[model samples]
Target: MADIDVLRDVAPGVMPAYRALVASGELYSDAAQGMAAEKLQSLWVKLRGYDPQPKAAGQNGWVGKLLRRKQVDEAGEHPNGLYLVGEVGRGKSMLMDLFFAAADVPRKRRIHFHEFMQETHKRFHKIKADPAVSDPIPPLADMIAAEAALLCFDEFQVHDIVDAMILGRLFEALFERAVVVVATSNTLPDDLFKGKPGRDAFLPFIALIKKHLDVLVLEAARDYRRERVQGLRAWYVPANRYADAALEEVFGELTAGVPAGPESLYVSGRKVVVPLAANGVAWFDFSALCGVALGPGDYLALATHFSALLIDGIPRLSPDNFDEARRFVTLVDALYEHRVKLYASAAALPDELYKSGEGAAIFERTASRLVEMQSEEYMRLPHLT
Candidate 1:
């Protein structure tokens, strides 16, 4: 048996919690095995030197020395912060899991970026309404601090105005209480708050991040997701006679044991109601289901909703069908965020979705996003020989 299997068999009870934590991605396996503290320190040093794979000879170099200092400080009273930036699937999340698992801290929580922002917004609104709240800011700050000494966030990207506005203050409060933050993102810190018309107002927050966290770039361009399934055939389910029944089965499995309300269901604060037309065909509104307006509490509520989706109305949308396209984008984002499996039916493949139009750019981006939603490998699939 493998070492992990052996470890599991030898200590089944203790291993169960560790396995559960790792499986839930709240803890990293390396950390559970007591290797992340050292590995993370080395990884941090290598990242600083622009080396994805550091050489044995350079293990004791200046970067290495700096890493040792950071590790020592992190292990001490002053919690250290780490920021990992890279393209999707370059092991950023995995590395974060390792670091989070390895940290000896008592209180820790790892949450997806979308879910975290949603939760923060939910809590903010709750505190706003309560008169007995008594100094909302400090109490709120203390609450997060008490709940988590270390906060590890995955898929950390800032594209919306609401998130941009409060992220600084939120981080500032957490940092003030010496909460260590480890985050992974596809974009660099400088590129994060960019392009917004009034982004200048967020400059102080940018400075605060630079001051509090040690930023590291994982520059390897190779897509780890691609590497994992280079030779695997794409999974495709064509719309057919049995498609609806199969889709319903998948949906039933996802929503099993949950109470039924409207044919449409609401997950998280976001609505997942299935709007039916006069013909009785089931459809859904993505924007209402998963948007930044909702919070983590909403997602927690949604977790029990549906694990898979089957939407049959997708086709080559036109300018007249902009609403449909927008809804599709929303569904794509929700599925990606929740890591839910999906089987969709479009009148044509993504490439053929936009045949010709002046609005081709919008269609192209949407189509690309849809393709990505289906399978990242589909983006690189070779045309039929």
Candidate 2:
């Protein structure tokens, strides 16, 4: 297990790491974050080579020197970092971002945990193409350590057996190289991979987390995302100029007036163009979404990337565009399952969106889901990715 020593400064109120958190004004002031910032400040001091004491050997001489060398080696090889866990929108990720920006390490990287796992999967696949490579995890972990001495991850989660099985070995190697990690997650270490099929096989990974990292829970009671959009209009009707303007205004409120730009995303090797994306939300026209030849895979990928979607000009479905209506159904299912917030300007209500379409009977379920998704309950659901 990695060793930890409690550190206390002479002045109890000096908190260097809370600067960003206070400046952002994104959350209410809380003692939980202030304490976390102090811990992070201690880590930063160590990473900056701020140790003051030097060790001296006793009368045991060479024997004592050998024992001390072994201890030093072991301590040098193990990770010394922080693992932060909390519920959704408690500002765990936000705090990690502040700490990462303030850390003075020569090589550090902060990334979404899902994107890191995706890259890891890609690396393993590429290595496996060479039949001689039996186990690729060690080399991949080495590559990761070579790239970054400090790794900061956002929204870490484990749902699938593939990720669950490999994490133990991959992280063991990382810790052995003294690669520090700071991660934020919605779930605690013990609860990761809790209900999956090969859960027993995943236990060692949880153990590794406890051994190598200091786990802290953010105790903030509020969900900041919900607070931000609470009581705001979610659905617009009639597809008129006023509804269009309202949709745009809602987008601005959610995104804080950030400029939207196009992004190309890949799903099953298929390229999907998101025309307007900013601040974790994407905006799309009806034709760009339902009018194209797309499937559930593409829609699922969209849900994975964005927290919310603003779709404009959804027309009343008809028999002529039955295929588009089918795609729309698939899209709604993906978004609903992932709890991606939906903001739309449609020709009519959810029940009336496809009243007389070729697939009207099949779309009853879709309309029902659309109606449910606009509720306060659905908006409060946490995002899967």
Candidate 3:
């Protein structure tokens, strides 16, 4: 793809670069995705150190209309930003990645939303530690705004109350500093943090998002992620090389040619590494997840980020390793709640996995979920981000 910095001053913009990919058969044209690209093209041109000025008196019609946002903004001014919303596999992240890389802005950052919030928390913690630091948010926001004038976020969703509360004030300050934001999410602006505990306290953040960012829904005619997951066996028993091969196929199909690599997920400022991850699918050994001392937060973060999980070698549960057994159950609960596609190679069938143990009863419920996940109904369900 031609750099948007060149596309910025030149005639050919982001849309033409997208078309070149289509012509080369690397991508297929979708009107919905095209519209999103156009919107991004508008941003790509204007964000290259372009200083927008306050409109003079009587500056009306198309240019004036473009200067001030309607519906999403009541403050009469909004920074350059967009919030892309759609179901999975609409190419939201792909387009955002292109724009982020190609945007001419020198000070820019692209990050997963959770990681951004985690980093923010870390910064806040350090600032709060200083006795003289009466308020941390203002200076913190200034530093962030200066560092990344343009911020691109992948998979923007809030699952924690701590993040929820901090976002309102933090973003308000970021917007005040003219830090542009572009984010992608599976949920709508209204539905973010919906029905979560302490959701009422998070409403202000929702309002601020709607106020500052234009929400664009990328509607695509082609979404094969459901079909892709359906083709794979959700649970494979008698862990063997054949089962491993099946999982390899599943990972390939899910990621759609994205290169696999080790992924470190941050939970409460700690890193939980996945052996291999690409797109929204993560691959891990059962021991890596269960044998390790990971809590509900780690499990929840894993469930939230990945749409599909491939776990290798889930051994039979016993009283000897009840802690791992319990963690396995917790992991299953988180995955089921988020409707993540679970593919695993196990030593035995769910019911037979735990023969006799104090944690056997708990395994039964997870077993039932494993069975249900393989059903046609479950295969059709959308992964909740």
Number of the top TM-score candidate: 2
Whole-structure CA lDDT of model 1: 0.53
The top-ranked prediction according to lDDT is 3
Which regions in candidate 2 have their CA more than 4 angstroms from the true location?
1-27, 48-74, 77-79, 256-260
lDDT of 3: 0.80
Clashing pairs in 2: none
Q: Which residue pairs clash in candidate 3?
A: none
lDDT of 1 by residue, 1-385 (tens): 1123323433223334345445654433543233333435543342331211112333432222322333334332343577777665455665575455444555678876766777788888889789886646656665787687568887677767888888878787777555667887767788876888769977787787777677877754465334433433222234554555555444443332123334543445446444431111223433444323544444333432333344653556566656555545555555445544345554677767666755657667756766675675443331110
lDDT of 2 by residue, 191-250 (tens): 998888999988998998888789998887687667766767777887889988888877
Q: RMSD of candidate 2 to the true fold?
A: 7.8
Record all residue pairs in model 1 with backbone atoms less than 3 Å apart, i.e. clashing: 118-295, 118-296, 119-296, 264-273, 264-274, 268-298, 269-298
Misplaced by over 4 Å in model 1 are: 1-77, 132-135, 235-266, 269-385
Tens digit per residue, CA lDDT, model 3, 29-124: 889989999999998876756332322345543233433323124443445599999987788887887677668777789987876887899899
